[model samples]
Target: MKLLSRIDIRQLRILSSLLQERNLSRVADQLGVTQQAVSDQLKKLRETLDDRLFIRTSNGVIPTPYAESLQPKVEHILAALEDLLTPQTFDPRTVTRTLTLCSTDLEQIVILPKLLKILRREAPGVRLAVKKLELDQLSTSLLTGEVDLVISNPDFAPPSYPSLSLYPEHYACVASKANKTVRKQMTVEQIAQIPQVVVSPSRGDFSGAANSWFEQQGHPRNVVLSVPTFSAAKACIAESDICGFIPARLLPDARLRVIELDADVPGFEVIAVWHNRSSQDPLHQWLREQLLAVATTP
Candidate 1:
């Protein structure tokens, strides 16, 4: 008989749970089993693997080197099996799972509160974890199960992943409510003369879509500050003589006033991107629907 054949997949699941929960009793509670049952599974797993998988500690348990090495593989296996066994019909009110998403702080500020409010009322059992979206790493993160959805500009999404347009990212100029240089409306030339606080997603470059549009129109902005997020750029504009072009949704700030610019800066499409594997998944599809519903609201 093969040594591996002696172990059931359930035993590996216990080890995986142990890696997360650490305490045998906690793992039992999570799995809806008893501590003695978890110990039996661990004993079987240790016998099959020929190693002590966990060592008792004052807190609970610590994984041995061998068990640590098995952790990722075990997790991947369990996730795959769960997906395979997942029901076609999903009940958000009853399902308990965390949906991981990738987004920027600005998007989180604009979108998460509304979405979370809806979830809190409708799907209390579900949880969300939003991570920062790194453009170059998005494709790999989606394919490798690091993030389930990415809310980003369409241009930044990987072509391999399927996407749905969430909204048009429009920008308008903002300045301190007390700034004397800005008025109800500014001409293209007047707008160009003011020092601009440019939002560069990467935080170092003072260039962005507005800058590109300005150059295309034969007038480049006099950039005096570079910021990483719309919130920061708005704060910079509100506290200084600098003006910033921010998303239209980020308007109505108490300390900042929006200035109507004569120059037209083009807007880009914001999209919700997902891996091919999740395109047909009911849970994922439901999540995308909720995002679309929230994103399109006035």
Candidate 2:
């Protein structure tokens, strides 16, 4: 307790800002402190913590493993302190805040367009930044305030975080309009024989959600090509004889024909995930509400 008391809250804020800003000059500018003064504070923090919190890098500074591990706890501590000191109110219309979100390309394509339209009207001053979703690091990122929200499959979300079902994910097979193998209706045998363009989001991985479903149903897929994103899969189907599986939420391109399969394709829920700490935050809650509204509409 005595050692902790020696630490200044202002220094803690500086450390937190460093994680976001990465560069000393930027942090100093944001905090209205000299670069040398920020360096001095970092020096004091390093001595107090007995760890080199950040190491100088070509781009800026990178947090040490110890510093990286401490980020979520520090963010929680600072947020709790701020909540205690300030009135709990967020005026979306006038507040200028940047919200960072992580999501797959599919969700970004399906969700962001409508959400951005609503935000333009409802929260004109708010800004949004979207980062590609890194599933393994999402939980820690959310807890540390590195990302404000995550839109992804429920299975990918950490169990510790609170999640709300955004929509039920449905998939359909797509093929070029010129492909003769695909018709109005397809049976298991016919679908199995046709070459498939499987979307393996990780790129190198050979299997995906649709592949797993095919396995469970005792059907074999001839995966002619493996791609990383829905757009790529659709493009492959549009140009080639091979068919691709795509989430139903994505509108069908006029060039590609949607193939109706008789066999069942397993569906999972797309979820909006966030750390429990932000569950009651006005901005967070409002964002979730808007996402739910967009997801449920049509």
Candidate 3:
């Protein structure tokens, strides 16, 4: 407890500078502190955090995974400290900036309508840009402010980023109503026999989100098709004997019918994840509130 208390604001500033500058001497020079002073602080940070945090490279120093994770959080802490002196104020109607969101089609179909209504009625000048969800680019895009919020299931957010649960969602085993072979319910063994279609937008891989759960039940998923979008998967599944697990909210389609599983698939929470730098910013604050209102309302 005492060791952690030694991590004062100056050490945090040094940590941030070192993460960006990636050079001990350069960080020291930038912060107007001695190289030894920086090293002493780094040593303290390592002990307090219990992570090496950085390693010496030929060029200078590169942050370890633990250190990389801390970068955004440290910046947020610094930002919050800085915000204490500079007051922020804004009006929703007067705002004229576009907020970019990284999300999947599921969110676009389910959440965006309500959110757009609120935006149009309240913050008319605020434009919204939603890009396709790319999980690999999530950390970098958010850190650089290329994306404001990532609306997806909980698994996609980086460990350090802040997130709010927009809504709860569960999957439904769906197939074409035309699939006569399957019925209203199927056991794990029965469902495993059928070839399934999956949605993998960013990659051309056979891997799926629920494959492991199926495998745990002693039936490795036999994925016969992988499509880029839910609509594509739906079209394919609706026509063929193949099936998929899709969100329940997108159902009741004339072409599709639900296939109940005895052992239900676990649900996921759709969250709006954002970098912490926007924590105190009024635009993000107001926008998150509006999103929460729309998502949580019955």
Candidate 4:
């Protein structure tokens, strides 16, 4: 088999579209060309491949066996070519662009406030939209351009995208003053037995570092309820015996008492992720720097 050239691949894509639509006119409409243009391209495609790539059937055009076999390779090559041709760089200060970021509520509550403040003060023209995405979807979203950046737990494996650790935060058990059992610190067993409000922000299976530590010591926690937001869990904890695992840095003025976990649960890092294609773009670079500075500052 001969190696397909770039022109062959482009023609293959046009042929693929015709196969999908069946009607030459419809394919031409989609491609912003006339029916004659579509027919010409189809002729070129058939001659180049030396095969009837698509055959007109009663319903529509049907791809031949050869075309069927080449479809996957052709699609992959065209996608790669599209990526190669797409412009990746962005300029923050000058570009009036909206960047979509996927992150948990924890990042919204802790990091986004400061980050947005910096954007307002520095990059007034830039707009930010934040969405809460499940952990499983982060990598796919980055690859598909559904999200421009992802701020998530360090435990999440960095995808093909470039990522940087924004900051580190320790886990602390927080409860209301009215909760009599946990005043300062609670033992592993005590923590296990308590009515715990688990915060699974990303619909992640593991509860948190504190829960992981307890389970590692052969003591699994009795999570009474699982909430999506740390604030909601905190609110639930403030009114009842429910205790929540929260980031240590989130302990300033909330009406909850934060106690260090008895187990040596190491702090987790927060990461800022973006596609390598956009990593060096001036706007993305500036936004990343602002996020890091905000996350690290006291």
lDDT of 1: 0.83
lDDT of 4 by residue, 1-298 (tens): 4534525654766765765566777888887878887778788777776888888877768878887787556645655666677467655556778999988788898888998888887778888889985778876666545688998876775656678888888777778878888868667787788888777776744465566677788889887788777778778889998787778777754588876666666678889887655654567777888888988888
Better of 1 and 3 by lDDT: 3
Where does candidate 3 stray beyond 4 Å? 1-89
Maximum-TM-score candidate: 2
What's model 3's TM-score? 0.73
Query: Candidate 1, residues 128-244: lDDT per residue as tens digits?
Result: 998876877888788656799999887678987799988888887888999997898988778888999876665367777677788877778899888777888887888889887
Which 10 successive residues of model 4 have the least lDDT summed? Answer: 1-10
Better of 1 and 4 by TM-score: 4
Error of 4 at 233 (Å): 1.0
User: Cα deviation in Å at residue 257, candidate 3?
Assistant: 1.0
Q: Which regions in candidate 2 have their CA more than 4 angstroms from the true location?
A: 19-26, 51-65, 140-144, 202-204
**Candidate 4 TM-score versus the reference:** 0.73
RMSD of each: 5.7, 2.7, 6.8, 5.4
Ordered list by lDDT, greatest first: 3, 2, 1, 4
